[model samples]
Target: MGQLVNIAAHSFTAQDLLRMERVLLDALEFRVSNVTAFTALHLLVQGLPGTRPPVAALAVYLLELCLLDYTLLEVPPTHQAAAALLLAMHTHGTAGAQAPRLLRLARVEPAALARAAGRLVRIHRDAARPPTEALGALLAPIVSKYSRPSWCHAALCAPLDAVDPAWCSC
Candidate 1:
């Protein structure tokens, strides 16, 4: 039997997710990212187990997305990481645009989603120094936005009046 490597085991931090999201946005914000690119990114992230491994993919994919020829994205380990990196990618006004694609690709389990979100708190604690790039600047916000799953995001995204003190911080 295959030893299913649960992705949550090496969960990504909010800062990590944030940095990744920005790189994705930077790739997509301009003319770089379109629906096809978005879909491709979604396909990439779903295959990877969790958050951290995708960072390397984020860097690689960002370069590929900008360069225009994604043939290299088909390479072995790179393809795998790209899937995971893209899974966590986000942009303003298009935050959940790839949810359906991700759903189809990731088959996200409610338990896994919750577990991953719970793991976000850990990611937050670990992400002390973000990278010095466009993606680096986005670490705080994107992770804050998608660090948790929809259930967590709902409350995290909610107003301070509605938020609980404890879970909100980390």
Candidate 2:
């Protein structure tokens, strides 16, 4: 694990994100002194390391965010399309590239986001997380071009800006 973190830390090209990555990835478990145990527990439900398929990393990332914290997954539908655009290419019909990257990235691990992905299905009823004006700035362009989720018209209209470092590698 040290090797993995070291490699990721050194090669990690982003600058502003170092602090967030360190804090989030290194978040400690409340009950267990053993972070490894907690991670293992996370893997049990989420799958990690040898057990975790690379394909599922994205799905697992999102699902874990949802299961552990729903607020993290609460983005406007348009923003969701924009978020998908950030890291991947979407494949909706006639639409040249409207597929969400999460679908593609997580394609490596289909079942990981079983619920999180499903939740995307019912976006209108649910409120999105506060629009991180900083984050929205970054994703606006990508989302603009893509057809996005069929239901993303309302959510995708936020003004564009540079993507926030805290939200992604971008």
Candidate 3:
């Protein structure tokens, strides 16, 4: 799993791989961790270069939104991470060149990334105005956490109604 993460992340440092192995092993022993979407999310954020804090924060916000929807579980974590990064780039108006580069780095097909991103957009819209009070409560923590100055108020940023068409052309 760590090797898969390294491949997706484009990180090949021996020390880093060892550390990831140790962490995974420890988590397995404790029965407290699974290589979930967040794992891929972290690898993308930590391994990629030139990813700004705002982009990272927004990506995190999007992934957290995915956690609220059980349907998103069907999407692979690497795909989810790629989609989140793509959406974040688009939202920040930095997708001009980065989108294609991200596609190459994440090794995800443009159509697949677009589809995953579309789901995130729908999730974002639903989360913006949760249908039920219980759902709202479920969303509150993510919103509040990202709304903080520390997270650059990422949750306050408006979700894109749809993914930019250009991204799907890559």
Best by TM-score: 3
Model 2 quality (TM-score): 0.22
Clashing pairs in 3: none
Per-residue CA lDDT of model 2 for 1-170, tens digit only, reads 45655777755445435666666666853242433312433433232133222223322222222332345444333233333232211111111322232334323233323332334332211212335675445444433433244323333332222323332311
Q: Which candidate leads the pack in lDDT?
A: 3
Model 3: residues >4 Å from true position, as ranges?
Answer: 1-34
| Worst ten in a row by lDDT for model 1 | 155-164
The model with the greater TM-score, 1 or 3, is 3
Mark the regions of model 1 whose C-alpha exceeds 4 Å error after superposition.
1-87, 90-93, 129-170
Ranked candidates (lDDT, high to low): 3, 1, 2
- What's the residue-level lDDT of 105 in candidate 3? 72
List RMSD in Å for every model shown.
19.1, 16.8, 8.2
lDDT (0 to 1) per candidate: 0.37, 0.33, 0.82
Global lDDT for candidate 1? Answer: 0.37
Count of clashing pairs, candidate 1: 7
Model 2 spans > 4 angstroms off: 1-108, 125-170
